[model samples]
Target: MKGFITDPLQIERESMRIIRGYLQQDWTEKELKIVERCIHTSGDPTLESVIRIHPQGIEAGLKSLQQGAPVITDVEMVRAGIAKKQLSQLGGTAECFLSDPRVADQAVELGITRSMAALRLNKERLKGAIVAIGNAPTALLEVLELAKDPETRPALVVGIPVGFVGAKESKDLLWEEHPELPSITILGNRGGSPLAATCVNALIYLAVNREI
Candidate 1:
C-alpha cells in the first residue's frame, strides 16, 4: 500500500512522480520543485498540467473543444470496447443533421473532423464514441422515430444553422422526444461553411482534451 507523508517536500516529490508518469517523462528537479510548490499552494493536480499547457494554449485548446462537433480518441476506443459488451451501453448508432445545404455543411464538417481526431488520439473507448448527423431539425424527428428501438441509443444532433427553416425546430423537437441525445455544443444562428469547419475543429480539440 502507498503511504502518505507529512513533509511538504516529500508530498511534492510524490506528486511530481505522479505527474511524470502521466506525462510520460522525467522532470528536472528545478521544474519539479516549481510544479510541486504550485500543487502545494493550489491543491490542484490540474494546475500542474495547466502550467505545462500554458494559458494561451489552454484557451485555444478549450475553444477548439467546446465550439466544434465531436471526436474520439484511442482511450475512447478502449472504453467503447468494454461498453460494447453491454446491450444498453452501445454508443449512438444513428445521427441527424440539417438538410439545408448550408446547415448540412456545418454538421458534416463537425462530424468528419471529430472522427478524424478521435481516430488519431486513441480515446478512452467508452467515452470516445461521437455521433454526427447531417439531417435538418425536422429530419431529426424522423431519425428519432427510426432509432426508437429500446436497444439503440438516440443519435447526437449538431444544430449549427439555427434558422434553416425546419432545422431549428428539428433540434427542439428532437430534444423533446429524445432528451438523452448527446451533443457537443449548439450554435444559435445560421453559420457559413467556414464557421462550420471551425466549429468541427474545435469539437475535435475539446474531445481529445476531455480524454487527456
Candidate 2:
C-alpha cells in the first residue's frame, strides 16, 4: 500500500494532474474538462487523439442543461450512469426507452435495431434535448437521420458507440459531414456507455462549476 491514496478528491486531483501532463491540445476549458474526464474514466492516453468535439458541442450541452433540457439515452446502462441526483437539482432529467414495449414492437416491425426504434419512436423528445448514445451505432445513425428534418435540435450528442460495426462510420459522418450538429464523439470504434455517461457528466460539472 505504499504511496497509495484513498481520499476520493485527492485521487481525482492527482489523476487529473497526471492526465493533464499528457494532454497538450489547445482545447477550451470546458472541452478540456470533457477530455480529462474521458481520459480519467478510460485510462487510455491514446484516446486524446481520437476524441472529437464539434465547436458547439460543449456550449450547447451547457446551455441545454441550464435550461432544464432532458437527457435521452439509447440504453439503460448509459441512463443509469448519469448524475441524476445532480441533474435533478438543475431541474433536468435523463431517460432510456430500450425497455419500452413500443421499442420492441417498432424494432420488429421496422426490421431495425431496438436502439434505432427507440429514437424513431421518440422524435419529439430529441428537440433541444441532450442525447447520449454510447452503446449502439444504430442509435447514433438514427439520431442523425432524424436530425435532418430541420426541427429536431439535440443540444449535444454524446455519440460514442463501441463496436466493430457502424460505430466508426456513424461518428465519422457526424464529425465530418454534419458540421452544424452539436456532438462529442470518439473516433475509430473506441467508445462505450461509460464514456457517453461521463461526457454528459462533465458537461454537468461545467454547468455547476463547483466542487461536488
Candidate 3:
C-alpha cells in the first residue's frame, strides 16, 4: 500500500519540484510561475508547450495588481477561481457580467453570444483592468475589437478559452496580430477557467512577493 502526500504545503512544494523538473524553457521567472500554476491545475506537465506569454504580459499584470486594478472575467467560473480574499487586500476586484440581465437581453436582440455582449457592456470598467477570458471565444474576440482604442484596452489579457469552434482562431489572432497587447494565452484550442484564473493568481503572487 502506497501512502499519498497529505500535507498542503508539502504537496505544493513537491508538485512544483516535479513540474519544474519536467518544464524546460527560456521563460522568465514570472512566466514560469504562471506556467507552473496552469500545469499544476491541469496535472499536465506537457502543457508547457502551449502556454504562450507576450513579453510585457507579466509586467503589465503585476503593475495592474499593484495599482489596485480590477479584473473583468468572461464567466462566473473564472471569477470564482481567482484568489479574491488575497486580491481584495491588495485593493483589487474581480467581476463577471455574463449573468447580468442586460447582457442576455442585448445578446438576444443583437444575435450575439451573451459572452460578447458582456464585454461590450463593460468597456469603461475594462480600461487598465485585467481581462481574463476562459470559456468564450466570442468574448475574447470582442475584447480585441474594443481594445483597438486605448480607453478600453486592458492592462493584460488572459485569453484561454477551451472549445473546438472559435477558440483556436481567437487565440491565434491575439498572439499573431496583436503583439503589442500584453497577454498570456494557450495556443491550439486548449484552455479553461482554471488556467485563466491561475494565470491571474500567479500575477497576484508576484505582486505580493514583489517578484518583478
Candidate 4:
C-alpha cells in the first residue's frame, strides 16, 4: 500500500486531477482553476452548476489585481479568507468595511442596510477595486446602485451572497441591471464566504501564475 500523501503541493495537484476528472464540460484554463478551487473549497461538485462569469470578467479581474487595485470584501470572513500574502505580493490589499462603526451609524441615518451603508462609506476605495460580496444580499444590491455612478463603480464585482430571501433577486438584478459591468456570480441563493474568497483567490492565482 502507498503511504498517505503528506506533501501539500502534491496533495493539491492530486486534488486538482480528481476535480478535473469529475468535470465533463470544457472550460478555459482560468475558468477551470476558479471552478476547481470552488469545488476544492466546498467539496461540492454542484458548485459548477451555478457558477456564472461574465465574458470579460476574468480578464478584467486579473488586470485589476495586476494594477494593485484594492479588494473590498463585504464581510470580515470574506476578508479573512482572502490570500493576503498573495495580494500584498501583487501590491494590493484586502479590506472589509462592514465592521466600521461609521457603517452602523450611517445605516441608521440613511435608513439603509448596514451592508449598504458600508459600501457607501467605502465608495471611494471601491472605485476600480475588486469588490467581493459573499454574505449579504443587501451588499450586492448596494453594488448595483453604486455602479450607476461612474466614480464609485468597481473594476470587478464578485456578487455571490448567500440567502433565500433576497439573494436570488439581488443577483438577477445584477444581471439585468448592469450587463456592462464585469462580474462573477452564482445564479441561485447558494453562495458563501468560502466560495467568494475562492473566486478572488483564483484571480490572485491567475496573477501569480501570469496566466492572464
Backbone N/Cα/C clashes per model: 30, 0, 0, 0
Backbone clashes, candidate 2: 0
82-119 in candidate 3: lDDT tens per residue? 98987897899999988777988899899999999988
lDDT of 3 at 158: 97
Cα RMSD for candidates in order: 16.8, 1.2, 1.7, 1.9
lDDT of each: 0.35, 0.90, 0.91, 0.89
Misplaced by over 4 Å in model 2 are none
List residue ranges in candidate 3 displaced over 4 A. 210-212
Tell how far residue 136 is off in model 3, in angstroms: 0.2
The residue-by-residue lDDT of candidate 1 on 36-150, one tens digit each, is 4334433455544333311232233333234431322112221232222121222222121222234434436665333233322222221322332232343334334534543
In model 4, what is the error at residue 156, expressed in angstroms?
A: 0.4
- Residue 66 accuracy (lDDT) in model 2: 94
- Per-residue CA lDDT of candidate 4, range 64-175, in tens? 9999999999999999999999899999999998788898889988898998998888798888899999999999988888888989989999999998999999998886
Residue 102 in candidate 3 has what lDDT? Answer: 94
